[model samples]
Target: MNLIDTKNQLTEKKKHVEKVANVENATFMNIQLHAGEEVAEHDANKEVFIIVRKGKVRFIVEGEPVDVTPDNVLHMVPTERHSLHAIEESDILVIQVKP
Candidate 1:
């Protein structure tokens, strides 16, 4: 059993990304973004799942625009192109599943 304190990690300012877990089949990352911050378009090397913890985010997935809010989840397949932009100060959890 493992317990992760997401709130404590999310509030930290020294690092934008906090690694939650890294196992043989998957990796978990917690990411925080200030308003107007963006993660440029890129392809995922592994299947990815993103869970919005707070605020809102805009996602460009395969040329389609999608908006995500708190409690929303987005899933992407390996090699899919996507980008993220924070609509407000936001917190997100990213899970990458190895193929």
Candidate 2:
């Protein structure tokens, strides 16, 4: 089984910015954000969906900031310039569709 404690997965990949995934057409990632970890602004070719699994986050999209916490899901358009920061230690499920 591929059961994993996501919190531990974050600890394991904390130093790396990307992870190898097994999804197609779309990519699925169990992402971890250390407290204060900030992802720089970038644009996507297709819509990107984020689901906060643990902790808190702030989504900076198009120079606007959206605060988030567990159970919150945010979807961003392909052309929107977006970035993310972990306001507290966080675990996020990210799904991106490739156009």
Candidate 3:
């Protein structure tokens, strides 16, 4: 069992990635982005779930653009390509389930 205070991990960097949890079956991460910062398109090698924790973000998934706000949750398969752009300062949790 683990208890983490994700907000305390925030950083002033344009892009910050923090490992929140990891076990044999899954990995969890906290991603913080300042306005104008982005995570370039990439493929997730494992099934992935993205949870928007604060502010707003523009998500480009396989060439399609979708706006996301707090409480929005997105699911993607291993082969999916995606990217995220912060419309405002944002925080997101990324969970990847291994096969």
Candidate 4:
């Protein structure tokens, strides 16, 4: 089994993105963002699942804003265009499933 300590990856910097795992069918990433930090718009080339681990974030998907928090999970189709803004200092786990 593989274990990851998500909290240990938190950073004081504006943003941090790290690949934690890459298996045959999926890739896992840990993203830490300070309050007000933003990830620019981009296309999701593969199916995606995003889990907010701490604080909150606003996901701009196809020009629509969707607020996400630790209590929720966000999914995106491969063709979706999206961007993220940290509403507060936040930690997020992103999983991309390969086709």
Candidate 5:
């Protein structure tokens, strides 16, 4: 079994991104962001899933704004253009699945 620890990686002052696992069909990542921080818009090459572990964020997907929190998850189809803005200090897990 492979074990990944994420709690220690969360930070409050700066943006943090780490690849926690890379397996045959998927890549797993952890992302932390402080309030007002944003990830520039980009296109996803694979199917993508973002799970908010804590706090809240605003997701701009294909020019639409989506508010996401720990209560719900976000998914995107391959090649979808998207970006993230931290509404508050937040932590999230991102999974990319290969086709």
Candidate 6:
């Protein structure tokens, strides 16, 4: 089994959001976002599953914003226009299934 501690990656970035693929040959990734930061406006390349771990997140889906907090799982369909904001120093895991 392949395991990773999401917060312990040595390459973790200090600014903005950062992502790293942890599973071997699997279309999954672990993403981290800094507090008060925003991933403004982007089109999804695939169906993405977002899991919030530490803080809160707000997602803008098709112009409507939804609040996502810790322990929340969010899904976005392929090619959907969306954006995300970190409410309070969030840690999110994004799995891209159809990229």
Identify the candidate with maximal TM-score. Answer: 5
Q: Candidate 2 overall Cα lDDT vs. reference?
A: 0.78
TM-score of each: 0.86, 0.79, 0.90, 0.92, 0.93, 0.78
Give residue 54's error in model 3 in angstroms.
0.4
Count clashes in each candidate, considering only residues at least 3 apart in sequence or on different chains: 0, 0, 0, 0, 0, 0
Per-residue lDDT for 1-99 in model 2, tens only?
565444445555562244436556887777778888888888878788888878898998899999878767898878999888899888787788887
Off by over 4 Å in 6: 8-13, 16-19, 22-26
Which ten-residue region of model 2 has the weakest summed lDDT?
11-20
Best by lDDT: 5
Candidate 4 structure, TM-score to reference: 0.92
lDDT of 6 by residue, 26-71 (tens): 3666556677778879976778888887788899999999888766
Candidates in descending TM-score order: 5, 4, 3, 1, 2, 6
Weakest 10 consecutive residues of candidate 4 by summed lDDT: 5-14
Q: Look at candidate 4 and give me any clashing residue pairs.
A: none
Query: Mind giving the per-residue lDDT tens digits that candidate 3 earns over 9-94?
Result: 44544588989899999999999988899998899789998888897999899999988787678888998999889999888889
Residues 1-99, candidate 1: write the lDDT tens digits.
999877744355633877889999999999888888898899869999988888899999999999988767899999999999999888899999999
For 40-93, candidate 4 gives per-residue lDDT tens digits of 999867999999989899999999999999899999999899999999988899
Candidate 5 lDDT over 23-52, as tens digits, reads 999999998998898999998799999999
What local lDDT score does residue 68 receive in model 1, on the 0 to 100 scale?
Answer: 86
Model 1 TM = 0.86
Global lDDT of model 1? 0.87
Off by over 4 Å in 3: 8-11
Model 4 spans > 4 angstroms off? 9-12
